[model samples]
Target: AEIAGEYLKKGSQVYVEGRIRTRKYQDKDGNERYSTEIIGDRMQMLGARAGSGEPREPAAAKGEAKPAPAKKPAGKFDDLEDDIPF
Candidate 1:
């Protein structure tokens, strides 16, 4: 929450990177227990200031473009073979 409060700006989309951390603590009965949290490593701003609510992909380290969509045959499924036993 603290990291979000610090880095997140109003109407701006933010992405955070962190690792899970588990720590031991003492309860009221003096029993040892553990709690987990995400320790932030890095953060980035992606979305626009208009708050359009569109999800943005995470930034690549090398700023590489995503792979193009695979191509499909023009023929329909009905044009294919039917080897099934009905």
Candidate 2:
């Protein structure tokens, strides 16, 4: 399950819904203390870049790096993905 929050403006004028809980405590010097926090459940991306704009191309598909083909010989180490730093 996901909470979809939409139309969140860039600067302000945003709609928000949440709850505030208080913590009752006593200080070391015998003083009363409390704290409040706001928690949210759902949010949505409504900005121009939120939706699907551009598709992602794999590194091997592009000219970035050559992918190891199935026919290629495997390294002596079993952890192949970890062997490459990039």
Candidate 3:
């Protein structure tokens, strides 16, 4: 939720990479319940924030504009090893 609170505006675009997780807990009446959520590992802000009035480009283009440069990953997983299971 930290990313949502910090960067998720009404109309902003974001690219996220993570896994889905589910948690189980008991309710007030002792009933078991489950909740599923996405645990984001990396998040990238795309385009302008809400109300910024900037134009967004198509994710894929045939021959118009060049691709944007890659950005460095944020601090969270900068030092993580690249032996990801996937």
For candidate 1, the 10 contiguous residues with the lowest summed lDDT are: 48-57
Error of 2 at 33 (Å): 0.9
lDDT of 2: 0.53
Each prediction's TM-score against the native?
0.45, 0.35, 0.46
- Going through the candidates in the order shown, the clash numbers are 0, 2, 0
* Candidate 1: segments with Cα more than 4 A from true spot: 1-7, 50-86
- Global CA lDDT of candidate 3, please? 0.76
Q: Highest TM-score among the candidates is held by which one?
A: 3
RMSD of 1: 4.8
Candidate 3, residues 1-86: lDDT per residue as tens digits?
Answer: 77689867777777777999999999999999999998888666778646777855435434657768879746667678899999
lDDT of 1 at 23: 97
lDDT of 1 by residue, 12-86 (tens): 667677899899999999999999988878777776534566666666766678887879858988997898777
- Looking at candidate 2, what is the lDDT of residue 25? 92
**Per-residue lDDT over 1-86 for candidate 2, one digit per residue giving the tens place of the 0 to 100 score:** 13332434356232345677889899999999998877765333332334556443322323456755789666776655675667
Better of 1 and 2 by TM-score: 1
List the pairs of residues colliding in candidate 3: none
